[model samples]
Target: MLHDAKLPKTLWGECIRHAVWLKNRTLTKVLQGKTPYEVAFKRKPNLANVPDWGAKVFVSKKSKSKLLVHARIGRWVGFNDDVEDFEVSKGHRIYWEDSRSVTVERTVVFRKDEGKVRGFIEVEEEGVEVGIEGEGSVNNPNNPANAHISNSPTSPETPRSESLEPV
Candidate 1:
């Protein structure tokens, strides 16, 4: 997995740990299709939060200035055993964040060379509205009706459904 992801040899330990984690969750012939994790934990392991090995991750940086970049770029290394968090490698340090704390946007960037692909993962604020140049709002799927409501004069204004004042 490390070699395929083009990760450095120094991260061999992290790669091995991740491999073991995956192996435990995967079915084996010796176990008659049941995973080792299922046998030990008495339940199926959840793979929903698993990230691609060595994929670029944009983690939210804590205590940052208002004008500074909100995220720090890192490499997806593995998972934390104690909590449901992702272990990311940033320079010489390893940072982990609660899985439920942030929203993720994943995208695949294709290289000029065919068959070469790279994954980019970004963590963004939940419920935040992002607007395209002229395509309208890109995020906030919950409010689809407001998608077409833009800043242009021709676009109709959207009425506020909620109040900011204390009730």
Candidate 2:
């Protein structure tokens, strides 16, 4: 953890964040199929509803006292029907590695016991943790983003980085 270990946060809370990114990507890759939500709803289903793998979530109660039901919302970023439990969290900020730095955190649950009958997820956008690091290390001399413009580069942009290299 970036905290318990008294880790002063890596160059950017490096350990937990880095490990999570890899895990999320791998999960996204593996569950690239029709999820149960989709099968139940009878459509391909968009994954835009799911939150980050371990972001904190708070389930509300009628009690005025501030006893928040803390949990993590851990779902594979893509689609998967087999998993039924939405991992609840009282923990962290969520992010999208593939979708730029757009982020979200689960602040409250509008429907606590709606079960499968209730069909969708929603969350509030609070503190967004932006990953300052680019797609790769810039320190590497061979890092393409830092490459010099060349005379004979392929494609339209010579020595242009992948962002400009195009698909």
lDDT, residue 74, model 2: 26
Off by over 4 Å in 1: 82-167
Candidate 2 residue 155 Cα shift, in angstroms, is 43
Q: Which candidate leads the pack in lDDT? A: 1
Number of clashes found in candidate 1: 0
Q: Which tens-of-lDDT digit does each residue in 54-121 have in candidate 2?
A: 23334333465567544433212212212343233332343333342323333444224332222223
Q: How far is candidate 2 from the true structure (C-alpha RMSD, Å)?
A: 17.5
lDDT of every model, 2 decimals: 0.57, 0.38
Best by TM-score: 1
Estimate the overall C-alpha local distance difference test score of candidate 2.
0.38
Model 2 per-residue lDDT at 62: 49
Output the worst ten-in-a-row residue range by lDDT, candidate 2: 74-83
How many Å off is the CA of 71 in candidate 2? 11
Structure candidate 2, residue pairs in collision: 10-13, 36-81, 57-89, 71-88, 71-89, 71-90, 72-87, 72-88, 72-89
lDDT string for model 1 (120-159, tens) is 2233546443454242334444566666656457766688
